[model samples]
Target: MQRRKVTLKLYPNAAQSARLEAWTRLHCELYNAALEERIDAWHKARKSISYYDQQNVLPQIKADRPELNELGSHALQQTLRRLDLAFQLFFRRVKAGQTPGFPRFKAAKRFAGFAYPDSAGWRLMQHGGSGATLRIGTGEAAMSIRARGRHRFGVEAKPNDITLTRRNGQWFVSVTLRVPESACARRRTGDQRRGVDFGINDWATFDDGRTIDNPRWLREELPRLAALQRQRARKKGSLRFKRLGRRIARLHERIGNLRRDFVHKETTRMVRQCAILATEQLAPKTMSRSARGTVDAPGRRVRQKAGLNREILSAGFGMVHPMLAYKAEEAGTRLHLSNTRQIKPSQRCSACWELVPKTLSQRMHVCPCGHTAPRDRNSALVVLIDAFNTQHTPGTGVAARPKPLPRQRGKSKSVTRETPTTAPLGA
Candidate 1:
């Protein structure tokens, strides 16, 4: 069995919405109080407070504040569990020689959700098709909410936890269910293999001379965002500014949705065709650093570097690898991350295996042995070749030859464009 999460938008009436907000506020309060307790206890007595120590006093707390009793005990306990997890992560980072950010009290904005860790306090009253109804609490405080979305899991799937989250004034419920592996879509297998190279202008380049164009949604939306920011700045703290802020938020959400949709479709298609895949290992965070340096010594081309960084991030370079990995695992495909340092795909020739250095401005791979192709495409082929060579097995290499795309007469930019080709599974 594997766990899958399905998120659905919740539609609550005025009263139900109020009740949810109240419960969320109570949970936030409880989380903050718990964090304060731990900090104070440790500072005053040099002692650590375990989860159980705080949980044992819950009975007395409820007696003192009758209002909290209306919220489900299971939900409150889950909030404490979240706090415990936060502290655990802090300590883990400390042990790893990383910055140890101690868990801080959560404000209402930070604590926008609560979880039902078990099935005892909540139930999925009606679930099917495009919608479902969720019930929480009991008796007088019992609340039912209508949820809208296409849930991928079946009724037989066991729901392990339900998390209610509020984001940008929208309520959503995330249901984590345990379903049998057999219940998932049929796993695909194939002999076809390919290599992919990620880039900013073109989303991805394949060894077979095809490229996926980057949508650049963030770049397109930035002008409107800037305009909204200007308007908000002129009327800060006014109703007009608040309204513009909401508009900006909605635009950001739309950009995210568009990026996610494209990534899902492209990755799913790629996984189906390539049973064995290869790509250069990348560190996006290191690549997309701010160009502005600290006081002592500043960086050059600060504005230009910042623009390049924005473009790289807008292309969703970081999200692609993880998406491919999980999808490949589900489809029973292999994804090999070739070491960029060792292979140096961009610097090496795919055909002759000779080191041919090129600057960022050189978009064409011109080798001394007369082998040439688009820079990204050549890099992808090099990645495929290096991965196969490193493996200690025969008959595991890809058969497709990298065909160099035709370049424009005046410049090295390739004029040739080809559509992405996907092979049928088991072909």
Candidate 2:
């Protein structure tokens, strides 16, 4: 079965909203109390508290605090389990020689929300005309929230888990459903294969000489954001401060949403059109690292580097690649992450397969062999050709063919040796 998650915005009445907040607060307290217990136990007895030990005490805990009994048992258990997982991660990191961040107490704001491990405690209902509803809790404690989303899950699809979260004063539920893999499978076959070069000016340039312009959403909103921040700075602790704070958060969220939406649409279109996709494997973290130097030594182009870092982050190549990965898997498309060091897509000419050094300021690629093209597009073509260089023979300029497919009992199919068709870099 394939697992898919869909988040739905929830609209709860005043009473229900209050109850949800109360539930969130209780869960926050419960999580902190558990973390405190572990710290205390380890400090006093030099012994670590295990998940099973905590799980065994839940019955007594509920018996002592009757109020907690109102919260579903599974939800409470899940909270404790989350604490246990945190500790497990901490210890794992310690063993791996990484920073072991011990689980700390959570403020109500930080807790976000809780989850139901299975469909037993909650139900999702889809009405023909009235949209969807999420029913959480049981009997008297149960509340039905009007939810906004297309009901994509079918009757046969089972809800495996559900999390109710509060983000920026808004309630949302993420439902994880288990459905047959075949149901999620999309057979998208095509002869068209393409490569992409990612950049700051154009979000991506394709080998076919197509480009998606970078929106620079954050850069565009910076002036308005600065104005709001200035207003907020002057109105500290006042209602105006809180209002502006929300506005700032919403603006940030809007920019993020816009970038995500743009990437999703572009990636989906690419995956649908091509059977195989190729692009340079880039480490955005290393690329976006700060150019600041120590107290004694100053880095060159500090301000310029900072500006470039912001552009890189706003571009969000990290988010784009992962999104493309899963989408390509579902669409039955092959995504090839070419090694950038070996291929050197940006430094090599796609047409003559010759080294052509260019600086960041150079927007066009010019080769001595009379080959020229837009820099990013030329790089994308280099990546495309490199994708087919299976022999890894440097400067071969020969495109390898796809391996022959299997034969069926009564049908004969020719092996496809057709390579990716791209325009000359100069063209």
| Candidate 1 local lDDT, 1-427, one digit each (tens) | 8888878899999999888888888899999999999999989999999999988888899999899887878888888989999999999999999999988877776577889988877887555578788988888878888888765556667888899999777899998888787665435645677889999868899998889988999999998889988988999878898888888888899999899889988988888767767788888899889878978888889999899998888888788888877677767666767666545789889887767899988999999999989999999998777555544432222222233223312322211111122223344
Candidate 1 deviant stretches above 4 angstroms: 125-127, 185-191, 390-427
Global Cα RMSD, each model: 7.2, 7.5
In angstroms, the error of model 1 at 376 is: 0.4
lDDT of 2 by residue, 171-193 (tens): 99998989786677545645477
After superposition, candidate 2 runs with Cα above 4 Å error: 128-130, 151-153, 187-190, 391-427
- Once model 2 is optimally superposed onto the true structure by TM-score, how far is the C-alpha of residue 284 displaced, in angstroms? 1.4
lDDT of 1 at 291: 79
As a TM-score, model 1 comes out at 0.89
